[model samples]
Target: MTLSFSPSRPAYLGVVRVSAWYDLVVTAGFATPWSYALLHGGLSSVGDALGLGVLPALDPIQTLYANLMGSVVVVWALLRLVRPLAVHGLFDGAARSLFAMWQAYALAHGAMKLLWVFLAVEVGFGLAQLLPWWPSRSNEVEPALQGR
Candidate 1:
């Protein structure tokens, strides 16, 4: 149970890329207002069908926030997807941790149970990227810059 906080491990690059790909795939639909509207409708239908309450109709502010978040995430995802570095895993992991925290808070406050699906994925990816994939060795770890 030795935790390697070192993001300089080469193996971490794979984790970064995978996380980025997940973001791209999942959030792409939210990147634009039009697309988000469509996605919201689709999600609402799915939720209703599953007996989970539908997503609330997006107000202007909610739409704006969703679009902004999606845009930023898509760009960030593209960076790692194209040129993943070990350090990217560290930052992505941190971001996932924050997202999971907020999602949990929302769930606790009575947000959609469907969110649990997202939370699970977030936790999975966050832990995968944050945890040490291999045993740490001071003698073996590369310099931070070298990991780039």
Candidate 2:
């Protein structure tokens, strides 16, 4: 058995780059607590821009929760940029996939309709992270043959 990690293809890497940038701007909205003015507007003049249907009104608790979640997302985004090809990067993408699935499920069940956008974006980013690493028997065996 053998292994190789010569970095992913450029197309996949480009997808990750775009995804990271999107994460930056979107997570900023979550952490800032003042980006809920665009589009249809949020619960307040400035609330969750995504307008979480669950938290239709931004109270103290909602504010605290949003900030906390956003902070974590910021850290994850930084990690994605810093180590895009690292093993943990796969985990990061997988986590986003899960988040997307949850949001899609909620939207389908008539919960948070606003999550529709998230479902699409998350799935796209997740596929970018995951699909590139798919392994082939040739990839596993070719390196060993070349080395020998």
Candidate 3:
């Protein structure tokens, strides 16, 4: 008897694509300054009814960082959406893993610490992209010889 196992690509790709679209939408928060209200009001807040993170100081550097990250997120999503099959899962996993690690490091160093929720989400996405491709002994098998 021989055992076989095959995982569905559509389910995994569906998760990847949906997550990418979610990234695009959520990333818009980083692209604009108005969304910074979540810093104080918590990441769940919808409006900037509270004070902005860039007010009395106009910290251009912080603004630049936010826009840059947002742009990268948009591009990343577009890539996965455009080339779901051709796009390598490992590449997406590695990129997101690095991004998540960097975000974790920044948080440890007290940079945008209030955005911990975002960090958690990033880590989740990274894992989601990786788990499907992660190597495992369970996936390996040796063929049996006939008439041995």
- Number of the top lDDT candidate: 1
lDDT of 2 by residue, 1-148 (tens): 3333322333444555677778877876667556522322543333344455543545667666677877788777776677564344456578887888778777777665556667788987787666544565345333322332
Residue-wise C-alpha lDDT for candidate 3, range 1-148, written one tens digit per residue:
2222212344656666877788888776676666643432444232233321212233667767777888787888888788664134446667778877887887676554445666687778677766654455223211100101
RMSD (Å) of each candidate, 1 decimal? 3.2, 6.2, 7.6
Instruction: Give per-model TM-scores.
Output: 0.86, 0.66, 0.64
Residue 148, candidate 2: how far off, in angstroms? 19
lDDT of each: 0.81, 0.60, 0.58
In model 2, pairs of residues that clash are none
Candidate 1 residue-wise lDDT, 1-148, digit = tens? 3334546655667778878888999999999999999999998888888877688878999999999999999999999988887767767878999999999999898887788899999999988876653345443345543663
C-alpha lDDT of candidate 1 relative to the true structure: 0.81
- Cα error, residue 26 of model 2, in Å, equals 0.9
Clashing residue pairs found in predicted model 3: none
Q: How many backbone clashes does candidate 1 have?
A: 0
Span of ten consecutive residues with least summed lDDT in model 2: 36-45
Candidate 1 vs candidate 2: the TM-score winner is 1
